[model samples]
Target: MSTLEIKDLHVSIDTDQGNVPILRGVTLTINTGETHAIMGPNGSGKSTLAATIAGHPRYRVDGGSILLDGEDVLSMSVDERARAGLFLAMQYPVEVPGVTMTNFLRTAKTALDGEAPSLRHWTRDVKKAMGDLRIDADFAQRNVNEGFSGGEKKRVEILQLELFHPRFAILDETDSGLDVDALKIVSEGVNREHAKGGMGTLLITHYTRILRYIKPDFVHVFIAGRIAEQGGPELADRLEEEGYDRFTAVEA
Candidate 1:
């Protein structure tokens, strides 16, 4: 079974003043068939944690280690990490003007599997995933995220998640910029993936609405780049009702 483990990870970004630390010894783990939610206020390093795991070039890991299935992930290249079954759905997905959805999905599948998917079955699989997300059939022909609405872009990310079937998926603020209907659809798609078994998820969000549908196995309160509290689903409800005031005030 696939598992992701982060051990006292410290991430920083390079600037004119040299490296500025962002994630300070943040650590967590997620096993297969589980869902973990990370909620925090803005600039609390939620996105940085996710991006660092995905090996984004902008973020540098100054300390700690990340392992996937007992393999050292911190030592691998970004594509290597991806081939090792780690996926991150960005908060602000970029628009690839010339790459059609079909092409992008096909390339990703090819890279992940180390072989091209059968053309005969590829269309069917893409169509089925799109249909599940309530995406129009014609979307496959459009350039990735180009000219798409906020909700549509989110759905496209979900589509890629379903198609890729990564062992661990880090969804960063997926519920952001989505309408209630769009959020439900995206959450439903995630639920379907989790039910497939052996697929773990790390969902990062500031709101609890998506949890109403996806239901996290554990909820962690992230404050100041560190996990302040962790508990069952009730933790999510409490945060939604009481807000992060009590938790933030303690540190302040």
Candidate 2:
């Protein structure tokens, strides 16, 4: 099985006040078929970790390592990382005004697989995945995320997750702005891939609500850019009851 290992990761960003640290020596591991939930308060560096792993230029790696199946992930470019089987479902899925969803998905799949999928099979696969995500057929013709509702954009992100089938996925606050029914539909798409026993997941979230739908194998409490505590699913239950105050010496 594939493995993603984060070893003492340190990330920072430039600000008017000068460089500010975000992720402070974070270390964790995720394996194929496993789901690890990173729960934290806002500004606790949860998104920073995801961005760094995804090779976003804004987040600078001060020090540490991110290994994907023992390969040096930190050395790879953003596109290189994706081609190597890493996926990030952004907290804010951006809009591509002119690119149709179908074209975008096919192009991305072709890039990742190093060969174009046969048109017939590709069409059927995309249609089935869209149906599974409850995405309307009309979206296939619409520009990517152009004028999509929050829930719709999120569903489309998961649609990519299913179609791309990466070896590892980092979902950064994917539950944001989702209603109950939409959340369930999105979670089912994720669960469907997870049940396949080939992809690992790092789910970054703020609430336990989504956790109810996508059960995590391990739970980490991130506070002040570091994991202050870690445990099994029960930790999420405790967080729901007690909140992150216990983990953060300061107010959360």
TM-score for each prediction?
0.97, 0.98
Query: Lowest summed-lDDT stretch of 10 residues in model 1?
Result: 18-27
Model 2, span 1-252: residue lDDT tens:
988999999999999999999999999999999999999889899999999999999998999999988899999998999999999999999999999998999999999999999999999999999999999999999999999999999999999999999999999999999999999999999999999999999999989999999999999989999999999999999999999776676645
Structure candidate 2, residue pairs in collision:
none
List lDDT for all candidates, in order: 0.92, 0.94
lDDT per residue as tens, model 1, 125-182: 8889999999999988999999999999999999989989999999999999999999
List ranges where model 1 is wrong by over 4 Å.
Answer: none
Model 2 residue 148 lDDT score: 98
lDDT of 1: 0.92
Best by lDDT: 2
